[model samples]
Target: MGAAQDPNSPVVHLPAGRLRGATEGGVTVFRRVPYAAPPVGGLRWRPAQPRTGWSGTRDATADGPSAPQPYTEGGDPILGGHGSPPFDDDCLTLNLWTPSADDAGRPVLVWIHGGGFVSGSGSLPNYSGEAFARNGDLVVVSINYRIGPLGYLYFGADGAPGAEESGNFWLTDQVAALRWVHDHIAHFGGDPDRITVAGQSGGAVSIAALAGHPDAQGLFRRAILQSPPLGLHIPTPAEYLPRTGAYLRLAGARDVDGLRALSWPQLIEAAQGLFGETTRWGHWPTPFLPVRDGVTLHRHPARTLLYDAAADIDVMVGWTRDEATFGFALDEGYATATRDQVVERIAESFPDRAAEVYGAYEKERAGARPVDVLMDLISDELFRVPCVELAEARAELGRPVWAYEFDFPTPALQGRLAATHCLELPFVFGDFATWSHAPFLSGIDPEVRAGLGHAMHQAWIAFVRTGDPNHPDLPVWERYAAPSRTTLRFDAVTAAVEDPVGVSRRLHHRASP
Candidate 1:
């Protein structure tokens, strides 16, 4: 360890202007660096515009406002609430942490936070990038883009001026951020050529979507997707416009102009009302998400991969062992579900193959609780299967891709979380203590924490620097292919396993028709 500069003060220059940053633990961090102009007034629902130049040094040391969102915290034990970041329309800012400001060409990792494409910010404490700057000697970047109605709702078809062409504003915002990095990151000691864009959950979904964008080519050479919900069906506008109309009606708005006139809080309430009406449908209830509008997004990432889209880029993807436990840890009904109840719900979700789906899980985990079986089913349907499906698609295309499963169960919440969604964040970022306050990850064993953290962090660094995750200490992580279906299982001791838990996955395929 070494002495560091005062975290309250440091400065760097950018194409737009000079920025004041903060330094701590030998890593200097620049916060809230605007990558695009504020999407406000006439700019609302439009593609992100270029940031205006600043005259003098701009103070970027403080956290900027988060995009407007309805609150989602439900006071659950395992699921903490997050729609609470300071909100403002000017939320297209990015944060960065570098070991030094000199042009050392350190590998850069840009992070996109996950909040179901509705609520999340780059400035969350759990997303701190100091550890990467300090230990991996990499420049870490996180960004905020438009979200919720302002980011995803499609109203332009109804002749609303900015609504028609605004279906993919969020995706455009991401492209703008990447372009900013390519043009300016070198001045902050990062190698723009070696950038790797990474994210978990919805953010990972966004990365997958970006792979289909023509403009996103060459923005990054590598990608890392953690627990992307690949099977979540995205509804077309015709299928979803009723809810948009409901939101407008809820807000008592005659049109986009009237909708825009409402305050942020009012807009959030209207969106929340629509979510309550639609959440029962089991599709993603958020009003904002990527659309299949042939322009910004050409096709679904899985379909894109089938056609070799982004085949030249290297990808590393994985999911935690029990990804759905976090969602139900706080739901008494789900936590106490009976075998019949589980079967009935699964039937409802996959009406075409309800019995076959239930039979597959019941047969795989005989004598296990119906609730437990259902949990595994939900996890596979939402994350694990998608992880394998994406990897398989990439492998079939002859693209370089590696897949893994994070199996380190948490010691918190009486060990009930069981390696649930987002449990791998601390290990991946190598910042357990910084996230000690997180409801889902608190109280982790120090010994298990350190070993897993070091391994995951190093693997990410190795992948970013050499385009391969293999190193002297890591187990031989083989490139994923269908014939062998070789996969890495990361736990207290990491190892490569052949088709770990393929029974349910195989059953899922058989049942899908």
Candidate 2:
């Protein structure tokens, strides 16, 4: 992609036809290229089909629409931006940034945005691929998959059209995107064999699951999972089937067609309650999760990865130092949390290991309040311990693995956020301007931004180019192992540390429901 082509021409000829791109900073940027047919009308719940070729040069200058999903309660994207971007059911497009059109065979990087499987699109400014393409001399691609009920709802009942194929249609959309890139990326000067899938939060969870899927094995060689909720349950048909009837009752739909006939607002209204309904394995009440359909996704993503399908690929897994601080301290949940409220929350979140979780966090935060201990407990149980376990599993399998702990505290909101969830996003993209109005990053200045941004950006670029994430900007990092659990702690003074979350790892045992 770095090799020089016709500088005046910003068009690439593909088998589908031709794509005209916009030039910015010496990189040709293409937005909203369809990887699959629109999932609307009769295709609402069907498996994604290949996007047909165009007859003429298609204009790929504008961003794509987001999938039909409900808005965040406050309309604030602490991870990306505020409010909802344009949305539609016919939203299945990808954005690409490449250095040039010539055959350079540069490594390809595919980014999957995180919104807890409910919101966020690939076209968000924070995931802008120009910086990655320009700096790394490569081609960067970010894709959009369906979210919300349309993405995760499981209706295992027969005669529900596509329900029998698989309930996790979002994962199907992801496979289609990778297949498109595998077949077509080389035409855009990217190497099909050098694909590296990188994602954060829910996107991380999706990528982790996709990495272990047998159907998705050869599409990508490596993966980067940032704060994946591995302990989060993947509901089977028995667990999710009843919710289908509840949805039907709420929407007044007698059957699948009746459900399809309803508008998005109606669909979202009926499904909204499911988001907060606590399941037996739910720690955060995320009911609209990837379903474990025996045909496609047979087991929990972590279990499938660790024990079976993850033998071939290499991965990097990590979490923020104070993941729950994003909610506890930033939203004033800490100040108002009652003793009983804290206890109930902890018990509900970790029913079986309540005592063990409490003791571990109490030792970790000595002299801290019960609420404070609860905050770290939720953080480790959902993210820290699960992340460590994932790396440890890869180490046990003798596959290459790298682990990290993002410890850079945001000085925003009067310095309350201490390395909270989604804080490291800007650094990875090297674009603080895109997140200019983000509340989590409000007070972090440009100088502090540049140092960390350069380090992470370089490290990710190196990971794409090579399998390893090590570069000169950070310390000498080693692969995560059992006894020492070597990890790279990224901060103002970044260094490699051993057994950073050793206490929590010992106390916690992840059992997927």
Per-residue C-alpha lDDT of model 1 across residues 57-106, encoded as one tens digit per residue: 78777778988886655534654655455798889999999999887999
Score each candidate by Cα lDDT: 0.79, 0.80
Clashing pairs in model 1, backbone N/Cα/C closer than 3 A: 73-81, 156-163, 156-164
Candidate no. 2 TM-score: 0.92
Considering only N, C-alpha and C atoms within 3 Å, which residue pairs clash in candidate 2?
none
Each model's total of backbone clashes: 3, 0
